[model samples]
Target chain A: MAEHDALTRERILEAAEDVLRRFGPQKANVVDVARALGVSHGSVYRHFASKADLREAVVRRWLEGVSAPLKAIVAEEGPAPQRLKRWLDALVTTKRSKRVSPDKELFAAYRALFDESGIAIETHVGELARQAAAIIEDGIARGEFRPVDPDETARALLDATTRFHNPAHAEEWSDPGIDASYEAVWRLVVAGLTV
Target chain B: MAEHDALTRERILEAAEDVLRRFGPQKANVVDVARALGVSHGSVYRHFASKADLREAVVRRWLEGVSAPLKAIVAEEGPAPQRLKRWLDALVTTKRSKRVSPDKELFAAYRALFDESGIAIETHVGELARQAAAIIEDGIARGEFRPVDPDETARALLDATTRFHNPAHAEEWSDPGIDASYEAVWRLVVAGLTV
Candidate 1:
């Protein structure tokens, strides 16, 4: 049992990630994860109550990998508008890379897990939107952007720019003229916010 | 064959729409449409050629219903900028009203047909984008909006506002705050395009 063995739990998670990567989320099982780490499947259950829980943890880890950097960007010292632009650029690039250029298999895995791990994903989106809201709030305080409810603006921004950054729109993101599309969206955002 | 009688062909299509509406894309076959119209199934085939063709025609008719009003708006006498706003506002309203109000059943039916009627849907999207481009081209020529390529800007605009009008995002659009979200998006579009 991993009840008191935190290291064993972490190791199992690492092994689970590897097994999932190798076999994919749909085909990968807890027994396969345990086999990857040379442990019985019972110990895996000691750490994660069920297969669904393990999938949720892996998806949480992947989503955290994305939002953590944005949270840091929100905290960084800079002009709010510029920081917002940089943050959005980072979000787009990271999403595109995850979804298309480098690791589509993992992205595909995440997409499948997202529906299964609904609460984990819902929480992650809330955190990211809050980060956007924080940046908007900062911009308004500095008198650089228009006065609007930061939370509403954040949702609007996310919803409006969904195609540019959403994984579901990955195919369109790779179109020959996608850069122009991104620029047009950013121009609109900046124009709308500038005092 | 009903081909020689234009009125009969129209009557068959009207009955097909009714059958598709009632039984939906999956259950509504050509035979069902013919049964609804009290005609021989062969007559339905004479008009549509195949079940796929019948579905495509139904989807094309549905999509045309959405865009025909916009085409008129594009041709109406007005300043380009004002017309553009009117066009977008009209788009959001029509899309929302169709998606949410009395005909949600039909919207669901269309979503089902959209998958089955891919070419029809693709052609419909291209036509809508061209309509947007025509409005943008007029605005650019009138010197009311920025000097951007009408076609690219039209794609960008459609991409940006997709969530508000796209069927995939219909659930989110029903959120209580959707009106505010639509207003925020319009503000950005108008601000970004103003000379």
Candidate 2:
């Protein structure tokens, strides 16, 4: 019975994402999600306290999916340069496919998380950036990347990647084009401080 | 009499920009503008045909203002490398201070322009980019910048500047810190492409 409940929860979460992608967040309601799952609305309520609770779950799921690859890349033992490349690739892919719209409901969720004392976007992104910076700092120590301020370098790297991935700018790049573009970025990083 | 007419038109255009910036596009109505300016709404109609006409004047004013310095940089006969650096500095400075908030009714005006034609946002930016590319292409010809695809190099340069200017990413940079950051960017661009 516990396993069946968990399965239904997963089904509802998947349906929620589908609704979000199709109708955007504002229109993605409990009824729509249940209809998508061919289940009764009561079943959704059994899993979630309310629509807000379910939406939060969907958002949390999206955030986890987005960051998982970064964690995996960081965990692997490799040279920092290669690790950075993999991280960039992962970031681009994630940003491109992740939530494509800034609907009002989506903005509200971000605002809610931002207002919460325990949840902050900066903290989440900063922690990942610091980890990436540590890798670059190590690379500099090993004479792989140029010797520059790791924090600043990490920020620039992230900034460049962010602009590249933003939907407003994504149309400017194709998948293959982005790969080669990063090559220019890599060369710039290496040239600035490489011995 | 003609000079006085031009002054009233200029005043109305400035007033429109101020209203849009303050209240966003929806509230930037002719009635509101008249109330703000102590003029009859009918008087505004005497100078401009409609809100759409006023918005076009405002956008054109903004584009011309932003592009003016870059134009001067290009017009001057000098080494391509020197001109490129000056152009970038001028471009970034212009973009950083002059931002069009999404709240501005100008967005709808831009949308209307798109509907009338197929011109896209990137293409709009691309026109300015091609102008900047000319400087880089000249540098390549003179063996200042590296011999690469000038258009791609141009896009990358604009991409860097655009990211630097986006208001959402404003916290990513500090005014005092941005110059150093841009220097780092310049180093990267030079390293990757400079011959």
Highest lDDT: which candidate? 1
C-alpha RMSD (angstroms) for model 1: 3.7
lDDT by residue (A120-180, candidate 1, tens digit) is 9769878878999999999999998889788877877887789888766776787787888
Pull out the clashing pairs in model 1.
none
Per-residue C-alpha lDDT of model 2 across residues A157-187, encoded as one tens digit per residue = 6665556654455454554667666665555
lDDT of 2 by residue, B1-195 (tens): 453355487787778767766666655567777776777788888877887666666666656666767878877787886788888888776665543455324544434443433334344567677877898888888887767778777777666555675444544455567777677667656655666
What is the DockQ of the complex in model 1? 0.51
* Pairs of colliding residues, candidate 2: A146-A193, A146-A194
Model 2 alpha-carbon drift over 4 Å, by segment: A1-65, A74-83, A100-119, A134-144, A165-195, B1-12, B18-24, B27-50, B76-82, B99-124, B170-180
Interface Cα RMSD per model, in Å? 1.7, 3.3
Count of clashes, each model: 0, 2
Backbone clash pairs in model 2 (N, Cα, C under 3 Å; residues 3+ apart or in different chains), count: 2
Highest TM-score scorer: 1
In order, the B-chain TM-scores come to 0.92, 0.71
| Candidate 1 global lDDT | 0.79
